[model samples]
Target: MKSRFVTGTLVFMLVFGMTLAASAEVTLRHWDWHQPRMNIKLKYMAEYEALNPNVTFDTQVIGWDDYWTRLMSGVAGGDVPDIAQFHNSQTQAFLNHLEAFPADVFDYDRYKEEIINFEAAYLFDGTFHFYPVGIMSGLIFYNADYWEAAGLTEADIPKTWDDFVEIAKLLTKYDSAGDIQVAGFVPNGILGVFWLDLHYQLGGTLYGEGAKTVAWNNPAGIQALELIESMIFEDRVSEVGFLGFNEAMGTGHAGMAYSWSWLGGELDNNYPDLNWGVFRLPTFDGKLAPGPVARNNHETGMSVMRSVRQENKDAAFEFLRWLYEDTDYLIEVNLVLGTAPSNRTLLDDPRIAASPLISAIAEQVPYTNIPGEIPHEVENDYGLGMLQDLLFFGYPAADALATAEAEANSVLMERAVKWYVEDLYTPVTD
Candidate 1:
């Protein structure tokens, strides 16, 4: 059901609407990086066009790798799409170029209250530059067949890190020579999210007071690295690169993998026959107290460009308001995202209530921290990304974090957050 947050504006639109003739037609140019999402958006665009006959869409779906390059260059050349996809990670880079939610068109306070974690967007500057469609957070997706074969049941779902380790051992398979053949839990590509989740769970923060430098070399950080190191070495439940995460899971060689809710859509699309089950990330002490279970990353649909002409901008905002106000569209797109709606109104909808996967992820929303953008090199190449390699090469936990700290700080020095939200890391004390 559409909430009162939007129903009133929708009624106002209908009551004071004017039909635009073909002579005054408008074509809003839109761009996004995901083909599946674009597919969903395109379907809704058709519905939008039917309602406002004079407004049509010119859309483009760019490859994710080339998306920002093409977009930044386009913006610099004064050829920016009227509406472009947005990610909070790009807030520092594109915040100025994006338009805030127009006060006349949108109630800022309503959005702040209606969205599940609107405070998560403190990193997106003070403006609602993008429409946050959903929030993405980590989850452990397991191979259902493997779980059954291991003689596990719903009672076996892990509630804590210790429980996960035991289950992973039972799910592991060994080769003739005793080397691992099938992994019980794969951490491939987890990178920053994995590191940060574990770190935060134990009361670590990524930055110090000024947000000027690294603050992740402390006790909690070391413990997080130790836990991962032990998982790969002493526990031996998983090999560093055995068959890879998604590939192994798809082929039934891996029992579980650490990934975001978005993986649901990817796995469904790419591995149609794989039987899978997901659980929200396990906690440190078998409870939510000490810290959040995981960190969340906000997902945006389309950010209107502040640089666009008035007519295109007005039309773009009008269409976006209508697009989100539709209940069916929200439900379908939430399915496409593999998450329940970010809109609080749809949380109790039958579709979300019936899906175990969505329900599990939704439970974690309130507990997840929206740790601001992790830098590319900091998360990937020379920082947390290198921890596994360091661990594989026999680096001690403290030394591994020290190594990552130095490498990550080099990037932090250059990419210090322009603004930092202390609440982003404030733990759930309850």
Candidate 2:
């Protein structure tokens, strides 16, 4: 067998003749936090280079902690990679850096039907800025072994919020002297997932859907925040401060941890022997809960930068297209990154069928929705800051949420005015 590098080089040399233009030569700079999966990245990069020899890739891997800072600097400096990986939380920061998905760029309409359940993730106000990379759904993950040790069965899983609390109390373990041993449930300490989901379940609206006003201080909002406070103060489940989901899962300190599909990969890496399964978070008051859960999960997504040269744009877009349309490529990403694929067609892949964690997310697709894209500065910088203060810090939930709503409204109004002045906000289509 040929060495890996030689094999890769040969593969690309063969494909370069088919897809690459004679005069085209492009280089792409990509940044992502998958240092552990460099091999997988190299494999895909090699294949992509072969298909488009005229397009070359130069990658830079950054840890998730520093990646955002570096990415923000790149955006501010107007220097961005043609194709870069992005998280949902970071999507808002780069919206302005993305150009419309031009017809010359790709055939959106032809692939539209193939990309069901993706409109909210990539399309915004009639402008399509991203080829959505993956979709994430928040679910409660339970350790099967822990539940069994507690004499609980699959049928014992909670169906509603009240039921969940009771089950959590039951599964909670105490040492001989009555000291807490293991927690029954640990909600991921994310304001958006943990607190926001609670707020939605409690029937609170963060902002008026039309963006006309703030409305997070309603009864439901207070109720939701109070419930979270009680989970920490009253129930005394997990530790008081922010305990990361990864650490909670790795140590098996909690029977249940709320997280997205990413947890599947983490568990495999950190606790390979643990038997875990996922279930939907319980609803509030048992009215088949709505709001946050139903609102859509892809408000944050990756986008192709508009600043890249035309040739790199085409190559990067090609890679993105393959990622969405190819089954093997999609599965590889799911396996390596643990993020669910945005492409609807990949849902039924055999690989997903074999993995319960991935299948759980796939099964929820019909029920999933995207929050849709909004102005980045408003949602990312201003909104998340208020969220950190309200949820993470000890701020009164009502006042914190109310302030966040006001700040969000202010940002929206400012963007609207600018769009009007620059004539960039015109409705090109109905």
Candidate 3:
């Protein structure tokens, strides 16, 4: 009887161990900077957990301004999250710290065919570190009421830079003190892509052969800068040193501004009653250029950290696959986010194609240029500052652009040397 009792106890202990192992939980920590989209992500997270009961999510949404700083800190301290969202423009900065997604994580041929501009934006060093969440395009957002008040219609929308300035002059309003009460068009704040787009529109490229030289000091760039100068000084339609000019455009303080597709959603949500319309930015020669010439592609995506444990990495990748591959979920999330679809399939979906706003933005996809796959923040900052000097401090456009080119080139050369030494400068190939 004692021997029988011992055997039964052993069997019970074995069964208990098996149950504990089966119930073991795997938690994936995620980080993203888009605080407003947390609820949408959380809903999907809950759905994913329901499907895989053994997995759970620990998600944190940080403010955009502080996010990069925090992320770099985490990377430096070796406390990075399992998965994180990063801008495509900033991905080059974190390549060494990120884990390249395995072949099975996503089907390469299908992705290249289905995602718009994926190769230009996300493909890096012969592999993809992240899956794009959305594609954003630089666009012109105009206040419809203000445009009409200036006696302009859709038919009157400018088709060339000369026509644009003329319409802008008509839209300007001033206070008793000669201060700009309503700007015709504000070109100076936050939106950094204006000059870049203008450069491309004029048949200019930012980088030269081998992606190791800066080419913005050429004729195309000079013409772009001259036009911007003409707006601020010659036509006097746009003013310098105006803060929050982009937001003011929505409040009817401005007629038009260079902005992104995301601005439409923000205006709709924050000022639902405001009447606005979207348009492609005018070209220098009054003709649409082919192949991403008038717009800049600003896309963001998700990547897994190299430091995550094997089991957690598997769970994280599975979650990403489900997040991107599920058509219904992708549509719902993007609808809430109000971003252009990264998946080309969604671009053809009747749901997306039918929306006037989405259609308008999507139309620019083929004409947008993704900036070079190099560290560009420094270049952008320096160029913008030089631009401000031209607009606000009366620096010559030629001088400012030359200075910008020199400084930007210096940065590029330094980065190129470092990347080459580390064997990280493998350019993406067709």
By lDDT, the best candidate is 1
Flag clash pairs in model 1.
none
**Model 1 lDDT per residue over 350-416, tens place:** 9988877788878787777765667778778878788777776777878888888899888888888
Task: Measure candidate 3: CA RMSD.
Answer: 4.7
Which sections of candidate 3 miss by over 4 Å?
Answer: 1-23, 176-178, 190-192, 269-273, 336-338, 374-380, 417-430
What does candidate 3's lDDT look like per residue over 1-430, in tens digits?
9999999999999999988876779999999887656677788889999988998999898898888888899988988889988776565578877888778778988888988666666667667888766666667778898888777878997778889888888888888998887788877674335787788777776666665766777788888888888887778787776645567776788888877777877888888988988777787666664544454454566789988798788888888888878787666656656566888788877877766566766776656666555465444666544566554677677777777777777777677622211111222221
All-Cα superposition RMSD per candidate = 7.5, 9.2, 4.7
Query: Worst ten-residue run, lDDT, model 1?
Result: 14-23
lDDT, candidates in the order shown: 0.80, 0.64, 0.73
Clashes of 2: 4
In model 1, what lDDT does residue 351 have? Answer: 92
* C-alpha-based local distance difference test score of model 3: 0.73
Model 2 residue runs over 4 Å out of place are 1-24, 36-39, 68-79, 212-214, 233-236, 239-245, 285-296, 299-303, 372-430
> Where does the lowest 10-residue lDDT sum fall in candidate 3?
417-426
Clashes per prediction?
Answer: 0, 4, 2
